[model samples]
Target: MSFISSPVDWTTWTPVIPATLMFIVKDGRILLIEKKRGLGAGKINGPGGKIDAGETPLESVMRETQEELCVLPINPRKLGELWFSMGDIPDILCHVYRADDFTGTPTETEEAVPLWYSLQSIPYQRMWEDDIHWLPLLLEDKTFLGKFVFEGDSMQWSHVETGVAW
Candidate 1:
């Protein structure tokens, strides 16, 4: 079967979950986590989680960062949004952010093992496949909108629109 099947018909589907992710960078390094529990466990990703009822995406990202890493993100900028769909799972809408300022040192919590990596040496093989496409744009301080279809944990197809951050 072709991985690139047909694009999802958003008009007929609804994304039930709203999530957030933040990348904290400084001096050419970025903070990532090895999730110890919940969705995407064991994968390397930025700190973030589901947006709670009555909370904005930015608020959720900051709260998640503090809960997962024991640090509060400061001045986080909205980098993009990603919509994901899998064969039989409910769709997900994820808001992505980049935070260059934060208070306190990041410490590993029960939810994640926090680690820092040089931008050029990011462990993409250990992250979600869709990250490979949009992360570079983030590194360049560009904004993007992305969509992806996944089969299980593997990305079946993806599309990204760049240059809309400003």
Candidate 2:
């Protein structure tokens, strides 16, 4: 595959948008969502959204989880970070978290439909291409940082480092 290089230098990159993603893993199953609107719509991913002004990443993750899945993640732990450069679009920095427990039921909303998949059967083909590269580190409870450049939905270039301190 031919890879496109990022125009912006990653070492000095700053994201125009900051977001969060939370996965609730329990009993060998992980909770994900079929996003119905906004970026990554029609794809399966964790329930999360952009962080609001004055909201910490943790606060944003909890709020987003509740808004998208109607569940309050309990004792959520930060797992990693993902940075994306999608062509001319501004860069995005997403903080990822994992919650082994939560309150309430995973329900369908106008924004998303929650689904549980076994850890061994995560649907990578239905998610962003970069997910297949870093999600395994998340499932293994490893800390990581992933950077990627994309053209539309296709990943052009990528880098991932595990055991990274966030």
Candidate 3:
């Protein structure tokens, strides 16, 4: 199930795990997190986690955001989907979302530390390599689909397409 090459057959690819990520963007800043555990620990990213049994991606995103950041995102909208193949780990499919509003304060938890960065100041170097390819599209309110292959913390290959519908 390796996808460490270009022109991956995405139509036939299936993920072993389904996850979600949510970003709260407002006032020229986006809410990100310094992950404290699990995959991508110590990296900056949005609040999200694996989808629980019987839970929709949207439900998982909202639940994860509250558990990690103590905030409930308002009017979150689906923006894109990402598929990842990391060597030695099961394939993952992540649903990404964005919300312009939220209730409650962004607080740190055992899972993550809340952080806000201006649109022009995203610290890409400290985030996942694939983020640099598709995050811009999310900020511009464009839909996207991305696939990536990684070995450890280094990305081996990637494909990204914008203006996708669902």
Candidate 4:
């Protein structure tokens, strides 16, 4: 008998954890990217991308922003971290950062089209389902830590509540 007769199984779903950086301004506006393809295509999100190996979160954010938006975020602070799982694809453990200062002009890259939106006027139709869940806390200068669930591109639910904030 052959000792190696294990069947190959390829049916599995897991969340993809990508390190992301969100650029924020004192004007309560956030820079977002309109995805062109894959996952939330045509949807809007912060300028970010996957974290490379042996790279820190800050470094990853800088590189990703330059590659995708061609902008440099300045004086950003490490605000909080979050864990999100949509279906069974990959769990996204995002380290959220805030930048009250930044420089350079954002350019539209292949992955996204750069745009800015006020917090209240955020285009929900263009964002992931869970974005509405904890985004408010972010705008209020509150550090956030939470988990959210989503089915495909729509957020299913969340159990998050920020105590108090600025």
C-alpha lDDT of all candidate models, in order: 0.89, 0.92, 0.93, 0.70
Give the per-residue lDDT of model 1 (tens digit) for 73-117. 889999899888877677899999998879988998999999999
- Number of the candidate with higher TM-score, 1 or 3: 3
| TM, every model | 0.93, 0.95, 0.95, 0.80
| Stretches of model 1 off by over 4 angstroms after superposition | 1-5, 11-13
**Which prediction has the highest lDDT against the true structure?**
3
| Predicted candidate 2 versus true structure: per-residue lDDT over 4-91, tens digit per residue | 5655598898899999999999999999999999999999999999999999999999999999999999999999999998886778
Looking at model 4, report the run of 10 residues with the lowest lDDT sum. 1-10
Quickly count the clashes in candidate 3: 0
Worst window of 10 by summed lDDT in candidate 2? 1-10
Off by over 4 Å in 3: 1-8
For candidate 3, give the lDDT.
0.93
The backbone clash count of each candidate, in order, is: 0, 0, 0, 9
lDDT of 4 by residue, 93-153 (tens): 6777778767778888888798888767888766776676667777777777656655676
User: Which residue pairs in candidate 4 collide?
Assistant: 13-88, 14-88, 14-89, 14-90, 15-89, 15-90, 15-91, 16-90, 44-126
